[model samples]
Structure formats: structure tokens, C-alpha cells
Target: MGNCIICGKPVDGLVCESHQEDVVFEFDGNSPSQLTPDRYYRGTVDGYADFGVFVDIGDHVTGLLHRSELDRRLESLDWEPGDTVYVQVLDVRDNGNVDLGWSIRQTERDFRGKLIDAPDGEHHPEDVETNDDEGSASAGAAADEAEPSGADDETSSADDATPSADATVPNGRGAHAATAEPEPVEESLAEETEGGLNRTTVDSIGEQVGSVVHLEGEITSVRQTSGPTIFELRDETATVECAAFEEAGVRAYPDVDVDDVVALQGEVERRHGELQVETEALEILAGDERDAVADRLEEALEQEAAPTSVDLLADHDAVSAVRDELVDAATVIRRAVMETRPIIVRHSATADGYVAGAAIERAVLPLVREKHTRDDAEYHYFERRPLDGRVYDMDAATGDVTSMLEARDRHGEQLPLVVLVDAGSTAESADGYELLAHYGAESLVIDDSRTDEEIVDAVAVAVAPSLAGADVDDVTSSALAANVAAHVNDDVRDDLVHLPAVSYWEDTPEAYADLATEAGYDETGVSERREAVALEAYYQSYKDKRELVTDLLFGDGEATRAQDGNLAAHVSGQFRDKLETELETATENLESRDAGGAEVTVLDTAAFTHRFDFPTTDLLLDELHRRRDAAFTLGVDEDELRVRASDGIDVRELGEAIREAVPDGGVHVVGGRDGHVEFLQGEREAVREAALEALEELTA
Candidate 1:
């Protein structure tokens, strides 16, 4: 029996049951079943497979370290055959398959205590009998005589009875430090070793520059430059780049990888005003020591990266139903930022979509800045793309996959988190979501549109009122995204409060409107910003134009004043003029007809209006729908059709009828319930006649 080293409790070994996981054990057993489960063991890297690594624990037992247990990608592992590694014995199945888990600690010295687990039972190193008692007694006498004056004789004797700090044993190498009198080798091997290394955190690394230091952290990333392999290490406090050079254009420390916990011993140096470590030696930590490091990091991350509990920004019941989803979405985005994963936001090219995308961008940029020490992290981390249509089609998915794959190969970047704002809710986007999923990329959809139920299975997180059994009309995409953004980073919640109001063209929710009003954005200001964003969204539909959009929406009084001809006023005027002019021409060209019981207004958009004008066909259709008093309005260009009707009309049903009536017209519901359709130019007249007939049937 012995006293526990950590808690000072009586035990059969150096540690007690509660602290058993605190120490790493070296397995001496010959078979898999002899190995104790839940205990970390030092193992040898036997080989590798596509799925995981094979490790040999002892002469007769081998275990499989599956890749799923790894914290990072499998391709990033640098382990080689014959390298000593630390792993935890997770299980020994009935078939004698020993399942292993990766350990963060690599060296025996990092562990608090060591044990030899044999087929018979667990045995401490001190339990082994030796014939060096006379030598041990002489060493104890020498240690006691050299003790400090204030130390009690009993304490001195106790300290002398234990191992000396410098005593060596089998440490992979058989070399031992010779002394006149040596302590017991088993006790020496069981004790932890620091070896005069200055252990420090990454945040305090600045003070240790020009000095050799030891830091324990998880490798966030590894980039191989022409000269050195740069391993980006992040502890709880901060992240730093450690450069290990074998030679020019050669790899260094080939066994290390991103997410591998390692004890790094190096000299801190300043390169280009950034702190980097010039690695002298890097060791991957494993066993109980590794578990402790991982546990510490996990605890720190839980404390720092967890999203704050959201207080409902709006008090609507519709918003309350999916409050958990909103928080989850926010947390996912935040966690992605901390993990250095790039975020790609795909939103519809509409006012509501732009507002929603911009709100997330605003919330995420500050976090990117705060999390990464790199100057260009904002650009490297976040990207916002405006989709040409509401659906995230195969075309869009292909483009995203192509670009992200290129980035991965060229820059060694992780695949981005694809965030769909005000888009990707319908079944039409399923193909796109699947493409992303096939590549192992994560996706999120936050929309207020009526979505198909199948979309729930296609995405990691889907936050839509329709999916939550709430009325889709009760909330706006901007409001949902704004609430999510507020929770993503609460510091910018006030900045995003005005966004939901700006998204509404009419009947802005009183709760969100009041929020905007309190934030000094009145109805007129909101309208101007909305109109301006819509106009600008057309010019360069692909680019996010983040700064320009920010200036247009949240610019101060001086920015809005006409003295400088602010972007908001200029674009808003353009929007009004273009929309009004289109409305005038459409009104003059309107052909009124009675279809069944409802009044229908049909405008030949190709002949009467400018097709290639500032206001798009969809925008013009929207304006005409709002101004006209008919039960249903239909706009037809040469080959395209746009329809708007009261809530009583089923656009999908109308579309189906139109397809049946005009077989070769290629009629389908293009927009989700918006009633847009397209046809071959040859079938325009037939399509128009068919649409009129279908409308009459629907109104009946």
C-alpha cells in the first residue's frame, strides 16, 4: 500500500480511484483482455489505414485507433510506423479487438505517475523488489543532509525516501544519469519531470520572447511553407504560430497534426511584428497527461466560446417557438469562427435577403477579428454571396464546391460553413444541400418562407417558422437572422435592431418597428435604406459590397445629408423613379378581363415596358401587384410570366393547370409559391391563353 501522490489518500498505488485517469500506465500485458479499460497506455505506431491507425500496446496485443476519435482531419496526422504514441484503451471486445483513443501527451515525463498493468493485476513501479537497498539508503542519507534548515527532519526523511528529481530509468532510451548514490529506479520513473523548462501560456508568450519556453496547446492548423512547417497552436488563452524547419521545402515533426495536443519547447521570436515560436523540439502529448490537457481545453472553450443565452429580442410567439433553434444556429456560427473555419453566407438577391446576410456578416466580422490575431482574418474568414435566385441550385452548389476545393488544395484551408440566409429552405435547394453534404461540408438554412419538410433532413440546422409550425407570414427572414446574429455576438445587437424593419416593404411588425424607432431609424429612413439596398443589389449581384452596404444602411446624419449626395438618398430616388415609371407604363398597357368571378389585369411586359431597365421584371411585378386592385395580376414578357394573387389562390395549383393546358410551354412554379413561370417563345400566345383559362378555373 502507498499514499496517493495527488490527494494524499491511502491506496494500493501512487494514485486513488478518483484520480486514476490522472496518470498514464505502461501496459506490460501480453493480450488485449489483460489491458485495463479507461486507462491511458503508451503504445507503438504499428501501421495506418484509410480509416484509422494500428497501434501495438505490447508484444502480443494490437489496438485500432479509429479516425472518428480524432479531433482533426485524418489527413493531417503525421504519425509514422514505429513511433511511440500515447492512447487510451477504450474497449476490448469479445473478439479481442482492442479499440484505442488518441492521447494528447507523447512523453512519459508529462504523466503524473506510471504503472505496469500485467495479466495478474496492476503493479506500481515501487512495488518491484530490488537488491540496491544499500545504495538507496546512502542516497537518502545524502538527500537528508542537503535539506534546507527550515525543513523538519521527518519531512526531509520522507522526501529522501522518495526518488530524486534527476534519477533516470528506461525512457525509450536506456541511458541513465550516473551519480555516486542513486534512488530507486521505479520511484524515479513514476515521478513527473519538468527538466528546468519554463512552462507558460500563449497569451504570456510575448514576455518570453528571446527566451526558451515550454507551451502545451492543441494544434489549430498546419501549413507547410517552402522553408518550414508552421503549426498554429491554440491554448485557451490565445493562438500562436510555431515554425519547425527540417530543411528548405521539407516537412518537420511529421507525426504532429492539427488538434493534436503537444508540449512545444522552443524560443519565441518576432517575425513581421507577429509572435512565432522557433521550435527546438516538439513532442505530441498522450495518455492521462493528454486527457488532462484536452479536458482543460474543452472546459476553457465551453467557458469562452459558448453563446450567451438569448433574451428574445422580439416578444412574438412565432419567434419564441424556434428560440432554441435560433440559439443553436448562433452557437454553430460562433464555434466555426473559433475553429478558424471560413463562413460562406448565401442569400437571395432581395432586400430582405441582403439585410439578413449583412446582419450575420456584421456580427461575425467582429468575432473573426477578436478570435484571430491575423490582420486579414476578416477577409479570409467570412464571405457573403448573393444568389441570383431564391433557390440554391446545382449551379450555385457546383460553384461553391469548385472554389472551396481550390482553396483547400492551394491554401490548406478547412471547408467553410455554408450559411443560407433567406434562401435554401425549399425542396428546390435539396440538390445543392446534398452536394455540400457529400463533400462533408456543413450547411445551415435560416429563412421565413414556407419550406418543404424534406429540407429538415438536408441541412445541419434549419430555422424556419414554417418548419416550426408557425405562420410563415408572422416573421420575416431579417428578423429571424437578426435575432440569430444578436445571439452570435451580443455586442452588435443594437446595430442589427434596425435590420428587421428595413426588410419589410409594408406592414412592418410593430415590435421590430418599435425597436428600429428606438434605435433612431424612423420609417422614412428605413424605407430609404431598403430601397437603396435593392437598387445596389442589382448592379453587382455577386459581390457583398459590405462597406458600401453598411454605409447605405447605418450611416450617420452627415452621411445621409444631401450635401455629399449620400448613397442612400441617391439609390432610393433611383428606385422610386424607376419603379414609378414602370408602374405608369404597365397601367397604360393593362388589358382588363373577367376570368370566372375575379378581375384579372394582364400586362404585356415585353411590348409595353423596358425589359432591360433599372427595376428588374420581378421588382416591377411586385410594385404592380401592390398598386393594382384586381384579385390577380399577370405580367407576361416574350417567354416569361409573373403572377400575383390574393392568399386564397394556390399558385402551385395554377402552375400545374397551366402545364396541363399548354403541354410544350415548360410551365413550372419557379419561385416558391410566388407563381412565376417560363415558356418557349413559340408558345407565348398559347401560354397566355392557357394562363387565362387556368386563372378562370382557379377563381371559380
Candidate 2:
């Protein structure tokens, strides 16, 4: 939708009757250049200068003109600011200041200059070329008299006899000349057209008189400045005066009721004052519709009337209640896990500061333990020890060495043990399931449902029998046995979505109150009002941060801070760091930031990788990571990666190979047309391979 220049509302047409009288000027279409460095001036040229002419526009503003930029004829003209010049608005800076641009004395010849030697419309030049008459001597004498002499002797004598132009200049004439005639040729070039119609009433379409037209907005003011009472209605559009109270025969006096939520309809008419609807035929809507309108108004007011943060924190209980609700389901699963015996626990840290394995170990283990032990089941625990390396601890829980350590130390062999995982563990998937299945161990994965858990579980369980065999070797063969023993449990499936990854500061209201009180705001009824305000604020901030991080990658910058000076730099750094933390944990597909500084991303908590949603948080982060890697490839220092990530997503790793790849400094990689990656430095194959590797664990 195209926006109206005056009110910024989207409109269908630019010059409809509703906007005919609106004050507007074209920025780029009519003028060759409109941007200005000079301020608005109703001034004249002070004097001509080498680079430009300086015009003293009254007080202190000076308009400039370069000698090369001006017409040569203006060099002899004495002008100053008091002489008006139409300066165009160019740049409006952050400091609420403006700059203007101006030009001096463009003539009609300028317009004709674009045409090749077009004749002047007066016909004098044509006559000069075609005249022929009388005796030869007489004709030659006549032609001699008509011709202009190269010297200006006669014109000079006439000018000497007249008053000086500057001394007798008319009041405001110089100002008018400078401003109005800045582009003299433009006026002649414009083709004027006669307007065909004037504004007509809506009633002309045969609408009933006094029928309600359904308008909603605030009443700005009620005044009787011009004999008749007028009420100004201000909507999203510009304000319009409604003079319903001025009309006779109407008891409806809405103007007297300030800020009233009214539903009114009346006949459109022109009064002595302004355009208004006659109140005599007005109707004030009643009943359910009126109530609904009032309700909507109330909601709007509430949204606008949120209280300070300090007040919210002071009433911590309410905030705490909401937090409790958000995590209740996850807590139930955590307790269930601890009770499950011989629960296979696996753990790994997400790049974001979250522990992923604990969810499975904490929630489902207890239930398994209790259910098995209650049935008098002989439960034997086994720990899988990889012979090749000590990296197997990547799948261990916090305190699992109590009984298993002694058995492993003494016998170097043990029965198949249940694997226990921490909340948000890295070993939940990405071949972890396949490895576990090969060892013939009963495997259970704790995972956020939004990620890989379900798929891995189903695949691993399909080979359950081979997994349970005594001689489990070569991961693929035992996979079928592990699948048969471990059917996907409905209980476990239902528990994933409710897993609590988020913590609510139940005591937030109090914290907010303390913060607000320290800031010195009006604390009246601050506690109750603060909670409502803070919750709404937090959500909004979450949304905003998400958008901002996304923009940093795409270069859209719609949600980014203004790219001016150090403020942008500082903000970018702070935002990148925060988003990095979240991205590392979730490996989310996308992320965004809200004004409240929350980092919301939708990636798995264990791996720092996820599918990239175009124009989403994940995409932005991926782009930044790609850039940082590129920079490293170009010989840029890893520390600078911090700054580059500030351009969008956070970078986690900087390998020596990447550093070497960037010959000059930092390697810049760009997404390729073929759904692959290429180094902007042109090392296509190497960069594509690296990007593919980074994306290996991400799901489609």
C-alpha cells in the first residue's frame, strides 16, 4: 500500500478529493535535486564565492552556491538572506535539526536549453531573417539601424540615468525572487490543467440522513472560536472539525462530553464555520454494540496504561504464579525420570549455557526405576566403555559413578546398563542413538520435542534385538535388537513438549518493584499494575529482539538500531552476545530479540546448529557465522569474529584451516545460487565444503 505523505496512512490514490488541499511537495519527481545542506531561508544572496554564493537568510543561517553551480548573470547581482529563496528540505538528522538546498535565478532559457535551437514564440527572430523591401540603399540603412551593436553604450547610458537596483529594491521582492524564481525555467515547463471537480458530500450517493457512519477515535477539543461550537475529531488520519453541536434541533451535545466513547450519525452539511454533520439527525448507539465498543476502548486503555517495572517486582507472587504454570508439566517429567532404575543417561552441553541431557535423566528415569523395582524386577546396570578413547564421558550424568565405577574397575566388563541423560544433553541424537543401539543397551533419549528425539528413538528401536545380544559389535548390526526391546512409549512421547527449558523468576514482581523504586517513578499501586505491565513488556521485547537479530544477518536492518556512530556498534555487540548464548543452546532454526532483552531462538538445545528459516533468526545467525568463518579464512583474527558476529549471528569456532583460507585477513563467504556456499574471496570448493559440514547436523 502506498502511504499518504501528510498522515502516513495507506491510501489508494495520491490526489483524491480528501487530500486535494493537503500541503505537499514532490521530493524526486519534479525537482532535479531536492536534498539540501543549507537551512530554510527567506533570504537573498550575500555575495558570490569561489565554491558557492553565500546567502544570509536572516539570523544566522547561510545558504551557499558555487560559482560553477550558478548562472553567470548572477555574479553581478548583490543579494542577501532578506531576499527570499525557496530552500528544499534535504536531511533531517537525529538531533531534530534540518538542512536545506537552494538555487538562484533559473530563467525560461533554461527550459528551452534542452531543446535544440527552438525559436522564441514572439516571432521577432523569424522576421529578422525573412524581411525584404524598398530600394537597396534604403533597405541596407534600415537593416543597419535594426541590428544590435556589439558594444552596450546605449544601454549603459540608460542604466546610468536610472536608480541603482539595490537602493530601490521593493520590500520582499528580493526574497520572492530568490525563493519563488529559484528555478525560473521550471514554471514555464509545467503544463497547467484546469481541475474538473470539487469535493462533494457523501449524501450525494443517496445515503439516509442521520444514519450512523461508524467512526471511532478521540475528541481532541471543543471550541467556539468562530461563533459556532466545533469539536475536533482526531483519528489515525489528520484531524477534522465536526460541528454537530452548532446545528439547531439536536439535543445531542457530544462536544460538551470530553473523551466520550460515542456512536453518532448525522447528515453532512456546511455550516458558517466548517464542514460538519448536523446533530439534529444524530443517534447515540445503545446496548450490546455500545458495550462492546466500550470494552474495546477499555482494552486499549489498559494496553497504554501499563505500570512501571518496580511495582511489578514488589508483588512477586503474581509473577511467580505465572512462572509456576509455565514449568509445571516439565517438573512432573523430571520427577518421573529419577525414579526409573538403570535408566540410560546421556549428557552434553549446548553451546548456549544449557545442560541438555538432564531432561531425560531427571524426568523419565525415576518413573522407570520405581516401576521396575516395585515389580521386584532384578535390575542390572551396565556402563558402555568405548575402547578407543575416554570421550565416552560425553554421555554420562552428574553423579553416576557410585556403583558402576567399582564394577568396571574390578572386572573390566559389565552387564548392559541403562543410559541416563541430563536435561538438554548433546548425546540425544546425531548418531548417538546408533552407537547406543550397537552396544545392546536399553536406550532412552531425553529431548525437546521440537528437535530430533522422536526420529532417533524410532530408528534405534527398530534394531532392539541385536542391541541386546552379548556380542554387540559394528553399530548397524545390533540396531534391530535395540529397536525391538525399546518400543516408543506413549508416555515418553507426551512428555517432550512439556519439558521445561525456561525458568521463570517467581519473585520477579518484587525484583521489578526494587528496580522501579531505585529509578524514582510514581509508585502508587505499583505492585498490582506492575505485573501486568511487565508480562506484556517481556513478550514485546522477546518479539523485538527476535526481529533485530534476524535483520543483522539479512542486512534488512528494519529492526536494527540506527547505524549511526558508536551507539549502533555497542548495541550490535550486546545483541550478538545475547543471541549467541541462546543459539548455542538451542541450535534453533530461527531466533529473535525483544525490547526486554530476551533471546528467543527455535533450535535444539544440545547442538549449535539448526535449519535456517529464510528471514528468520536461524538464517541471520547462519549468515553471520558464514561471514566470520570467511573472515578467518582471509587471515582475520578470531577476536575480530566477535565484531563480525555483531553484524548478525554469533560465531562459535575458528579453526586454523579457516584462518589460513582467508589470505588477506578475514574470509567473506556468500550463499551461492546453487543452495551451497562460496567464499566471496572466490575459493568456491573449500568454502562450500566447510558450509556443508557446518550444516551436517541440522535437519531439513
Candidate 3:
């Protein structure tokens, strides 16, 4: 027999009228006595709900509190798991579940007010008397609802029913006597260390021409041919070309200007055409410093051209040995490692440790082995180990024991190809791969994103996408398409380093439709190259804009100036190189197919905006002026033309007269809708020359 939990009363022979007789309450038969309730304790809560909390609270019974019965501020408290709270008895269900209420809210208002007025008995004896009087009145009313033999049926003694002499509520709020204050919040701080680089401050790398110091800037200019690639960087004073190299790595912003602020961190290089320092990281700060530098640069551009002499004897002598070594096998391997190829490491193609197909290994092995330096290739043994982040070891010599990750701080200094392992989610496979990634080797974690075959195919396409289309399904083709896309992206980045502000031409559905009508491809070779070409064009145009901006804003003593007008030439050359590489890889993978069917796609754009860093476009206006001079020999009075253009006066005769005033017989025409015109082929130049001769009569 369980005892009444609330009052600790014996319950074997006892039954209360409202509870324990049956599941339902009865209006009669038992005395009108309140049941011995469950232990009802109020707990501090983040919030209260009419229904119970989803979590368990020790006993088999769950606890709940009605919304009206809880304190209003209880909802405001920030509570978490394992917090203590206080509660009072309201009503309990027969199943032993408890419903709690707040007694402070249920207490008489007059009694509460008295307590609030005088909290201590010594300070407010009169208030205590008033509280007692109120309690006595409440007790009389409660007795009316009590059992027929109310006084006898009641369990409390006279003193228990009587209000305590010292009990008082402070300021009409609930008594805080029993409730403990909450604990202070806990927080953690990150540790600070020395040598930490600040992004905002300038880090001087070297001196340029003894006139200016070189600094790394955060403003990076991106040019896309097919994918996004960074080109030049805008420093405070001028823009510099960002040279990215596959083997030796990128060195400096090509044409750095004096007082130009650059935020760069890396080994500094200063010699000949490669006057910029190569950086591991760089950031351009924003604010008045940049504006002031730009203003100063513009002012300097107006000065008479200074003698352009470079004193490179010391730098040339210093870089002689290092430049020679940059052409070594080690450099080639370093270049190969930066490609970030996704490799599929299969222990065995079959379940029983059988070797994979020869063609697969033959195609992949050469690329991987190329990353090893001549010395590393000569004596390095085939060892099985988890080299870097989640990489497993599978030896070509003997597929056996796995290994641990070795801590090599110098690993990043060397190039290690990133590879993706294809395996099921077994503990052995996961641990092996993780070990490999930890060893300075990047790894791709494979899940449901793609299937094993798709993963393998992606690797194949990534390293060599120009390969003839594999007889793979649509799913595989889509995955392979994405892989080829990554390669194109990297190629675009590579292209931008060499190319100037090139524009990008996106392959729209209409472009694809046109491409599809022109030629057919193997299911795998669908007209993606068309789209690829368009993307490349877009990047080229984008590069052009950056060059224009740098030129207009910084003025052209900088090395980046040479990159202008030659982007088309560079793009054509690079496109050929990329195509050759892709074609070679494609042919190698598709030995069964003939190469005669292979073809290249060309892409073009109609209109593109020139991207620049400033508001002024005088460079374009100047070019227009030069063209104007070549086509027409006559010019109208500046004031007369200005008034005519402003008042919308018809000047077709004047335009013809200007066209006829040129020395050469060139045709005159306007390209844009807004009255802008140009001189072209025909007798217009001669007519303009004759007209100018006539106009000279007035001046003479």
C-alpha cells in the first residue's frame, strides 16, 4: 500500500471523497474532504505549459502546470535541462500525475499587501496583525467549503491554520524567502597569441625603385574565361597584375605603383619583369587612405613622362640561380600537385583482392607519379599509410596493412595531390581515409551524394575530360559533366592569371540550341564545350574591364598596362594548349575510338560593359577622339555644337559638313541611337577636308 505522498498520511484504510475511490470523482458517499495530494513542489522554469513537458521527471508520474497558475515571469526565465523550480499543489489526477500551482499568486491580496508594507515583524507589527486578520477571514470562507464536520475533518492544528507572525510578502510580489537566486552565467574566451596578423594594417614586403615600399592590398580583381579566376589587385595608388604560375606559384601584382597600399603575406620577389612579390594571402584595406593614394596617383599622371630606366642589375644577379632551379623536375611535380585531382583509391576491383583493369591504373598512375620529384621517384618505396585527412593506404606492390598519419609541418611547403577514396561506410574504410587526409593530403568524404561508379567516373573525367564519351548513363554523364566543369573552372583561373580583364560569355539556352543544330556529339560529349567557350569569353571581357579600370584610375606606368589589347591573343593561345591537353587525355582514355571525330567549338558575345574601378571614362572618350580625327578632317565650333545639341536642333548638314571636312575620303555614320556618330569609308573624309578649308575663310 502506498502512502499519500503530499502529507505523508497512511492510505491503506483511508479514501478521500474527490480521489482514490475510482478513476472518476464522486459528488457524494465520502465526506467533503480534500484528498492527500502528491508532493507538489514549484520549480523555476524557462516556461510553463498547460500540458506536461515531453521530458521525464524522475517518478513514473509526469508533472504539469496550468498556464494561469504559474507566475507570469516564469516564462521569461532562461531555463535548460536539469534546472530546479518551486511549485505548489493545485490538483492531482488519480493516476499519480501532479498538477502544480503557485501559492504566492493564490494568496489573499489584503494579506499580500500587508506583508509588502511591512516585511519584518519588528518593523511592522501593525501590518502583521492585519495579515493575520486577513488569513483568519480566508480560513472562515475556506471552512464553508470544507466537510460537514469541518473542524473535526480538517487535518491542520489551530496554530497551523493561523498565519505566522513574521510572514509577509515584500512589495506585493511573491515571497522570495524559499526561492534561491539564480546562478551567474558562464562564458569562454578564445586565447590570443603573438604574431597574429591584423587584416586592416599594412605589412611592408620590400622597397620598389628606392622611391616606394611594396604593400599587399585586399582588393582582388577576378576574371573568368569559363570559371572564376583572380587577375589584378587594386592597391591604394594603382592596380597591379596578379601573376599565377602552376610550377613556381604566383609572385606579385604585375605593375605596383608608388604609395600603393597592399596587404600581402608571402616570400617577396623583386627582379626584372616579375617585379611583384608573390603572396600566400593578400587583402586590400578600405577607406580614406586608398582614396588619398588614388588621388595622388591621378595627379602624378598629369606630370611630364619621366625617363623609364630600371636598375635591375642587383636583382638580376640575385635571382639568377633561383630562376634556373625553377625549371627542374621538382618544380614540375609541385605544379602537378596543385591541380587538386580527385583520385579513386580502390584496393581491388573485385571482392577477393583482384587487381583493377590495367587501362584505369595506366591512365591514373602517370598523373600521380608526375607529382613525385626525381629523387622521391628514384628510391621511394610503395608504403601503405593514412597520409592525410581520411586517406587509406592501398599499396600497388602488396595491398596490406594500413598506417597512421605522420605530423609533418613542412608538408604544405611541398605539393601533395588531393584524392577521393571510394568505399562503403565501414569503420575500416572511414578510419583509413581520415588518416590519409590528416597526412597533408586532402580527401573527399563520399556519402549518398553520388554512387561508386559515378565517383569513379567523376575522377576519370576530372583528370581528363576531353576523353571520348564513355558509354555511361545519363546519371554518370551528369556527374562527369560536373567533374569536367571543375577542370574548366581551374583552367579559367589559370587563364586569368595570364590574361587581362577578359569578359565572360555565358552559354544560354539559345546558344546551346544553336550549338546543338551545328554538330552532334557522343552522349557523353554533348555540346558542353560550346558553353565552356562562352564562359571563357565572358572571363576575357571581364579581364578587359579590370584593365580599363586600372588604366583610367591608376594611369599607365604600371606593368599591367602591357596586358591590354593582347588578351584575345593570349586566350587563343591558352585555349589551344588546354584543348591539346584535354585531347591527349581523351585519346588515352578512349583507345578503342578514332580521333578523327573530335572537333572544337567557338563562342562569341554581342555586347558587354567594360568593367573599371572609377566613375570617369575619359580613356574611351579619348579613343573616340582619335577615331574621329582619322575619319573626318573638320571640327565644328565648340560653342555652336554645344548649343545645337542641347536645344535639339537639326544638324544633319553640319554633320555632313564635318564628315566632308576630313583630308581622307572616309564615310561618316553613327553607331548608337543617341546622336553619336563616326566617320568611315567613302568620300566623306575629303568632303570634310574641303569643308574645313572653307571654314578657314572665316578664321583667315
RMSD of each: 19.2, 31.1, 31.4
| Candidate-wise lDDT, in order | 0.76, 0.29, 0.27
Candidate 2 residue-wise lDDT, 434-506, digit = tens: 4544544344433211222233343321111112232211111111111111121223332221112111112
Model 1, span 43-131: residue lDDT tens:
99999898999999977899999997763445546678999888889999999999998664456753545766666445554443221
- In model 1, pairs of residues that clash are 78-255, 104-285, 104-286, 105-285, 105-286, 106-284, 106-285, 106-286
Q: How many residue pairs clash per model?
A: 8, 114, 71
User: Which has the better TM-score: candidate 1, or candidate 2?
Assistant: 1
| Candidate 3 overall lDDT versus native | 0.27
On the 0 to 100 scale, the lDDT of residue 147 in model 2 is 28
Q: Candidate 3: which stretches are off by over 4 Å? A: 1-393, 396-417, 421-431, 445-473, 481-700
